[model samples]
Structures are given as C-alpha cells and as structure tokens.
Target: MTNEELKKAALDYHEFPRPGKLGIEITKGFSTPEELSLAYTPGVAEPVLAIQANPEDAYRYTAKGNLVAVISNGTAVLGLGDCGALAGKPVMEGKAVLFKKFADIDVFDIEVDAKEPKDFIDTVARIAPTFGGINLEDIAAPSCFEIEDALIERLDIPVFHDDQHGTAIVLCAGLINALELVGKKIEDVRIVCLGAGAAGIASMRLAVDLGARRENMLLVDRKGVIHRDRDDFSKLNKEKLEFASAASAERRSLAGALAGADVFIGVSGPGLMKPEWLMLMAENPLIFALSNPVPEILPEAAWSVRKDLIMATGRSDYPNQVNNVLCFPFIFRGALDVRARTINSAMKVAAVKAIAELAKQPVPQEVLAAYRKNSLSFGPDYIIPKPIDPRLRDIVAPAVARAAVDSGAARLPYPAHYPV
Candidate 1:
C-alpha cells in the first residue's frame, strides 16, 4: 500500500469504530435485575470485604491478576519526539490491541501529562494497585531510566518499560540468530550502536548479558563515541557511563566506529547511516536499522551496497523486522501468569532464547497462512519469528515464566494450564 493510502486507512480504522481503538466489554451476564444486583451492590461487596480481610484475595476476587497498565508521558512517542500526553493516546491504545490479540491479556492505556519524572513516578505508584503489571511506554531518556528504576523498587508487581526492554529483547533475539547464521561469536564481535537513548542502551546491555564482551562494544550518541577521556564523559547518565569506551582516540564518528565492526544496531533517526558505511564493516555483518517509519538505512539500499549483510529493520514490509510486538505481550503474559514481582535479566534472557529458537524451527502452517507465504525457514531473510506466529504465546510465555520461577522472582508455582 502507498503511504497516503495507509495513512487514510489507519485514521479511518481508528475513527470509524467509535473515535477510539478500544472499549470495555462486560465479561458476565447483566441482563436481569437479579444479575445486576449481584454484579454491583451485594455480590461485589462480599468480594470487597474478602479482599479487605486478606490483601492476597484481591488477585483472587478481582481482575487485578490479568490487568496491565500501558503508561506513557508522551515525551517520546515513536519517531515523533515530545508529542505530549494527549497526542500519545492513540499509540498507547494500539499497544492495548497487541496485548489483547497476542497474549489474551487486558490493558488499560494511561497517558499522564506530568513533566517531572518524580511526579510521573508518584502518580503511577499511587495507582499501581489496579494493575498486575505496568508497561511504561515512549518516555524520553535520563528521566526514563530514573522512573523505571524507582517504580521497580517501590512496587511489588512487575514493571517493564517496553521502549527500553521490549525493543531490546526482540532485537537481541534476532541478533543471536543472525550471529549463528553468519558464524560470528557474540563475545568477539565488534559492535557499534548508533543511538544511546533508551532502546539502544537497553539492547546493548542485553547483548552483554548474553555474553557479548563489554570491551568489544562501542556506543555512539550525537556527540560521537562515548569515551572515558572525553571532557563531558562525566555528564553522561549512569546507565550510558557503564559502556563508555576506554579513552579511544582512534575512532569517534559513526563512520569511524563502523570500520571493521561486525554488527551495527541503529535506534537513531532516518538517513543517519550511509550506504558506504556498510562497506567498512567486517565480512557478513549483521545490521539492525530499527528506526520506525524510516530506518537509519532502508533495507533495499543496504542490500544494494552489501549483498552479504544480514539486515533487519523496524518495518513489517521488510524481512527480519525487529518489532517490540514480538516480545512485550508474551513477556507480560508470562509475568502475570506467575505473579512475578519483577521482570528480571533471567526472564528477559529466557525470552530472547525462546524467540531465537522458535525462528530456527519449522514455521507452522497457520503462521504461513497468516502471512500468505508459501515457505519460510531460518536464513538471511528469516532471523526472527513472525509477530502473528501462534506459537509465540505458548513458546515465549512458558520460557519466561519458568525463568521467573527459577530465579525466585515469581510468587506462584508453574501454572498447571501451561505445558510441563
């Protein structure tokens, strides 16, 4: 479809069916007066009293166990920067659709207008009781780091910033599979990331957690390579500081960083990476240009420059799309199922492995039917499972839930409904 056509279709789809993308539906019968009374006055009070007597009963008697809050401050809505809270509602509602469609989870999209990070954190913390998990979305850097850390510490329920970890999880999973296809080792690969914001930092950290060497990775922001010798190095946030280079004077620019690098992960804006940069990378380099709407370099342009490169982007039209939709809903599904207190490194890593592994297996017929493709197998063109793959819920959720249980982050046992 043309860009103009897609624009019209998207606006029409959201507007035609009641000016918004979501609505609440009654889950039980309320046709009769007796049923209405039972649902509201007398019947509801019994569960309230039970929940008051024992705090744990709130999960048992209410919808809290299956509910997630998709919260955002609208400072960083997609590629549109600082669009504000009201402008970000549509994106949050779209996230709600993914949660329900992919994992059978319920979502309440919350957009807050607070400018200060503490105020945003306080507001979310105050209302945290209603949700089983919190999915923070599209808040900008520095403050995003602070907000996520504080909420995870302050709340017992699972809190995940999808912009930070969801993108990281899917990208890392695809990277792992890409490395296997290219015969490269994560510990030895020379990695250069073009963006040092939330998604880029989180992706690089998760890569390190999966055995990618810290010294081998170089993080570049707008100023250039993050090096210890830089005069403004102290000004960088604590999270970015951890990955600073050891005072390297040799390479600073994106072009310099790309030289001999085995991997290039771009969370930066469009046209930031040139076609000639791909020529500077190591043989069979893995390129993830994940900027939405338009990537750092278009897949066709990159492929024209280097036929050997394994490329992935954030666009569904292209092969190997590193989408957050592939990870967030299922991760929340697993966390909520086990009542996990936190979505830890182990759980995240488990999700990464499960997603990567699924791509290598035979693609199900139903998945092929959904995409209307005849054949799909693990190769340069297919490094990650399709977002519509039915097995994702069964595969990723169980793996994460198991990891949560093993890591002692979960409060409950392995669910009986899941496969043993």
Candidate 2:
C-alpha cells in the first residue's frame, strides 16, 4: 500500500472500532437476577474482604495478576518524536492489542498528562496497585531512566520500559546468532553504536551482560564519538558517563570508529551511515541499521559495498528484522506466570538465549506458510524468529520464568502448566 493508503487505513482502523481499540467485557454470566446480585453484592464482598485481609488474594480473585499498565508521558512517541500524551494513546492502545493477541495477556493503556518526571512518577506510583506489571512507553531519555529507577525501587512488581529493554533484547538476540554465523565470539567483537538514546544505551549494557567487552564498545552521538577529550563530554548524562569513561579512545569520528570494527549498530536516523563506511569494517562484519520506515543506509546500498556482512533493519520486508514484539509480550507472560517481583538480568539473558536458539531450530510449517516461504533456516538472512511464531510463547516465556525462580525474583513457583 502507498503511504497515503496506509495513513487512511490506520486512521479508519482506530476510528471505526467504537472510536477506540479497547473495552471491558464481562467475563462472568449476569443473565439472571440471582447471578447479577452475586456478581455485585454478596459475591463481590466476600472476595473484597478476603483481599482486604490478605493482599495476595487480589491476584487470585481479581484480574490484577494478568493485567499490565502501558504507561506513557508521550515525551518520545516512536519515530515521530515528542507528540504529547493524548496524541500517543492510539499507540498505547495498539500496544494493548499486541499484548493480548500475542501472549493472551490483558492491558490498560494509560496516557498520563504529566510532562515533568516527578509528576509522571507520582501519578504512576499512586496508581501502581491496579496492575500486575508496568510497561513504560515513549518517555524521553534521562528522564525515562529516572522514572524507571524510582518506580522499580518503590514498586514490588515488575516495571519495564519496552522502548529501551525490549529493543535491546531483540537486537542482542539477532546479534548473537549473527556472531555465531561469522565465527566471532561476543567477548572479542569490536562494536560501534551510532545512537546514545534509551534504546542504544540499554542495548550496549545488555550486550555487556552477554559477554561483549565494555572497553572495546564505542558509543557515538551527533557531535561524533563520545569521548572525555571532547568539549561536550562533561555535559553527558549519567548513562553516557558510564560509556564515555570506558569508551575505547581509538577514533573520534564515525569513519574512524568503524575501521576494523566487527559491528556497526545505528539507532539513529536515515542516510547517516555512508555506504563507503561499510568497507572500513573488518571482514564478515554485522550491520544493524534499525531506524524505522528508513534505516541509516538501505540494505541494497550496504550490500553493494560489502557482501561478507549480515544486515538487519526494522522493516518487516527485510530479513532479520529487529522487532520488540518478539520478546516483550512473552517477557511479561513469563514474569506474570511466575508472579515475578522484578524482571532481572538473568531473566533477560535467558530470554535472549531462547530467542537466539529458536531461530536455529526447524521452522514450523505454520510459520513458513505465514511468510509465504517453502523453507527457512538459520543463516545470514534468517537470524531472528518471525513475530507470529506460536512457539515463542512455549519457548521464551518458560525460560524466563525458570530464570525468575532461580534468581529469586519470583513471588510464586514456576507454573505446573509450563513446559518442563
């Protein structure tokens, strides 16, 4: 479809469906007067009193255990930039659709009308009890870090920012398999990230957890490669400080940074990564140009320069797409299944491993049918699993739940229904 056609279709999709994408459906019968009375008065009071006496009963007697809050201040609404809270509701509701359709989980998309970090934090903290977990969305950098840290410390339930960690999880998963194909070890690869926003910082940190060398990774921004010797280095935020302090002081420019590097990850905008830069990287390099709708450099242009590299973009039309939907729904699924107190590092690492391993296994006939392919296997072009694969729920979530239990992040045991 053309861009104009897609615009109209998206608008119609949200507008025609009762003006919104969500509604409350009664899960129990109320056809009879007796059923109605039980649904409201006497039946409801028993569970209310029980929950009052023991707060844990809320999970058993109510939807709190399965419900997640998609909270956002709309400071950063996808590739569109800061678009305000009400403007971002459609996106949040779309998020709700993904959660339900993908993982069979429920959600409440809350667009908070607070711009300041403290006000947004206060509002979410006050209303935190209503949901089992919180999925922070679209809030801008530095403040997103603050809001998440405060809420994670204050709330006992799992709190996650999908834009940051979700992007990282999927990126690392594809990167893991890409490294294996090239016969390079994670700990030994020289990496360069072109964006230092929420997604970029979080990705590099997770890469470190997965055995990438901290001292070897380089973080770059608009001014150029982030280094202490630069004039604006002292103005860097805390997250940037962590990277800047340990950033390899080898090269100061983008061209210089890519020379001899094994990986070039661009979370930045279009046409920023010149086609000539691909030749500067080491043999068998990996490129993840993840700008949405448009990438740093088109795959065709990059391939013309370097045939030995594997490339991933955010577009579904491309092979090895880096999509967050591959992990977020299942991450919350596992956390909710285990009644996890928090989604910890071990759980995330487990999720990344599970996602990476899934691509190497035999592709289900159903998956191939959906993608219009007779055969698909793990290789340079197919390092990430498709988002619609049914095995994701069975594979990724169970591994995460196991990690939660093992890491003492869970409040309950792994479910009996889960795969052993």
The digit string of per-residue lDDT tens for model 2 on 201-277 reads 99999999999987889988998888888888778899987778443455888998999999999998998999998
What Cα-based lDDT does every candidate model obtain? 0.94, 0.93
Which sections of candidate 1 miss by over 4 Å? 1-3
Q: What's the TM-score of every candidate structure?
A: 0.97, 0.98
Angstrom error of the Cα, residue 389, model 1: value is 0.6
- What would the C-alpha RMSD of candidate 2 be, to one decimal place? 1.2
Model 2 TM: 0.98
